[model samples]
Target: MTSPNAAQVPTIKSALKFFKVTSYITGIFLILIMVLWAIRLIWSADVWIGGPDGLIALAQFSVDPSTGEKVGLPGPQIPNDFTTVSLIIHGWLYVAYLFGDFRLWTLLRWSFLRFLVIALGGVIPFLSFFTERYYSKVAEADLKKVA
Candidate 1:
């Protein structure tokens, strides 16, 4: 007969699934932000439908509070501002990823240091893809033991 703790197998499976989904999503958004940053920093331009040349550079300028006109040479602005939206979305997704990480890590009873390392995956661009693969394998192995 299975041990009492074997019931945790299903919970572990669910937590693993949640962690995997969140890891993939967070990793994708992080990579997207990295690509966009590269475009803006390296090329000094971002894709924009309204940009005269089909691209626009991020700009910050002083504004005349009274006149409501941009001061100095007006800089280019992103017509759609998808970059900001992507960044904000990534921020929130990272939070969700953390929840998954905590849930999985808690269930598996792994070290806090390992948890911190896994957490870095959310911010380190392609790291999530790697961590997701590695840790998921580790979890699956542990799952076999539990079963």
Candidate 2:
């Protein structure tokens, strides 16, 4: 039979791995959402369809009589499907990331303020990458002491 202490060790190690993986995944999702949102914002300005009237301007296509080549309009607005999907996925990823942060923080018995800082990593761009590295190192060292 495994001792209580030995059982706890594996649980703690597994928790740490969970935190590490989720942090990376959350960070990636946040970056993707930010990029997609920016593109959507920029593209919105060029959209031909606008106003309550609807279909402000139909997509203009013309045939070049000289060459008989059909030419498409420039800056045709595309749908925001990518942006919408990224936003939704990132929201869910942030929730998972928070769960990971909570588990590690409580296990380590870190301060509540520290927990807040770790949580912010998901919302702030580029913060998750740095925070994950720092948190992992500190948690590992603390776990070594406990083990």
* Top candidate (TM-score): 1
Instruction: Quote the positional error of residue 89 for candidate 1 in Å.
Output: 0.6
List candidate 2 stretches off by more than 4 Å: 1-7, 45-80
Candidate 1 Cα deviation (angstroms), residue 124:
0.6
* TM-score on alpha carbons, each prediction: 0.76, 0.69
- Best candidate (score: lDDT): 1
- On a 0 to 1 TM-score scale, where does candidate 1 land against the true structure? 0.76
Give the per-residue lDDT of model 1 (tens digit) for 1-147.
Answer: 223257788998999999999999999999899988887677554444343334554443356899975454233443355576688899999999999999878888888988999999999989999999999998898888876
Q: List the residue pairs that clash in candidate 2.
A: none
lDDT of 2 by residue, 1-109 (tens): 1222444667767888988888889899888877656644554322234423355433344567899743554432344234445667889989989998898776667
Steric clash pairs (candidate 1): none
